[model samples]
Target: MENFDYNLVKVFCSLFDTENLTETARILNISQPAVSQSLKKLRNIYDDDLFVRTSGNMKPTIFSRKIIDNLKKSIELIELSLNQKGYNDNLFYKKNYNIVMSDLAQSFFIPPLCLLLDEANLNIDINILQVNQLEMEVKMREGKIDFAIGNFPALKDNINLISENLFQDCFVLMIRDGHPLIKSDGDFNNYNLLSLIGVDNNITGHSEVVNKILNKLGCKNKMNIPYYSAAPDIVEKTDYGVIMPSFIAKKYNFHNTFKIFPILIKENLIEVDVIYHKLFKNEKSTLTLRDMLVNNFRNR
Candidate 1:
């Protein structure tokens, strides 16, 4: 193992996780040819066919399988040692931080978080991606997402994740101010007469919960839109309404164009949590950002 290239080992581990040379190269920011060459070198060094190209994925050999856990543990240790320098105020200046958030959460959380960053004099580059529950753990493990903020139903009891409760949001009925459903102030007289305009939750993981709320409200008809940002305008134009989080509804109604009414149903509130992998539980940047988010939104 003289002059062993750790980069080749990294490519091997990444390939093991992703099962594709193209994907592994993408994750490591290298060329596909480079990945192939590294795999070739790794095979020569180990004197075994480490991985085999099948009809689908590049399946690892039994030898590779036996060492996968040790390789992961070694990589984790290296990362932990590299990040041992705890939080420093100067570390955040002009650095890029990626966060995974639901569209609804992005709408209401980013603005205030930006304000906090400004106040702290930190010129951090904040990037927000739409949350995908299925790939969240993978993304976090790969450090593709620094932090994830949203109501994650799949991660509620996931042992791999550690979460902090930021706040709880209840369901609200959002309608244009002059809609016929509103006969008077704070009164929705024709709730069932209007159809619902719902944001599709294929990626957001809120469809089941939202559907249950609509069922309780006796809303029989609904139209699904792909994005939540478009829900407000559609509700203002048509007789259709939206059942959304209280925070989003309040933020949307801030200009008085819409009215937000409380849901008259039991357990309508969902706890929005900030989640990260346990591996990063003690990392400086992760802690600093998580603490900032929790403190900013805990009371609001």
Candidate 2:
């Protein structure tokens, strides 16, 4: 123990969290070669290959995984001991939180969140990342992402993740104000016959639900677009219908250029959630951010 370098703990923990040499280097503000050297030293000290690079990621060995919890606890203990003499609010720290969400969620949540941060005089950076749903859980567990705000139903079943429902949102059909197929009486029964414009992205799980609805309705003539922003313009210029979140449709209906109709199916109702890894449940910064997000969007 006398010959051990304590500074290597930072590199070890960062490597374990990131599982990517480049990312670990970036987080530690060091070059990749430096990170590699530190990792080599750690491996020699431990007498084991702690991590194995496979498929472009460093997968922790069983020994490394078994010891990681204690190592993390030791680090946390050190941090707590150092900060025990001072009282610091988590929000006062200048840190960057990476969040995953759909573009529609960004439009609905970012403005209010930024406003709240500004009002509180907090020095923090919020980075919005667009990631595949399959990778979201791993990223959060690795601490690469802090939070994910959207309608991710599948994440509810993930044991390692904690999904807190903020509010329930339903789907709505959007069309131009004077859509040709609709009568003046506002009857939407014949609307199913019109071609639809569907969002293809599945990050938020919105598109999957939309696609199921389309399939159930026997709607075959549909064009799949990758973004929600493009749907509004297409609906305005053509005879296509769009199924989207009610809040988003309402936001786009502000100019009275579009008409929104509710989809009454139970599956159309989606629970918007603030999802995070269970590992961060006790973390002050994470808890503070989670509370702020829940409070900001719960009832509205």
The TM-score values for the models, in the order shown, are 0.67, 0.71
Supply the TM-score for candidate 2.
Answer: 0.71
Write model 1 residue lDDT over 187-293, tens digit each, in one string: 88466797888777655556767778777867754688777889898988887888888878888887899888888777587878888876555444566778788
lDDT of each: 0.77, 0.81
Candidate 1: what lDDT? 0.77
Against the true structure, what is every candidate's RMSD?
6.9, 6.2
Model 2 lDDT tens row, 148-215: 99988778789889998898888888988888888889867565678888788768788778767767
Q: Which regions in candidate 2 have their CA more than 4 angstroms from the true location?
A: 1-94
- Please report the candidate that would top lDDT against the real structure: 2
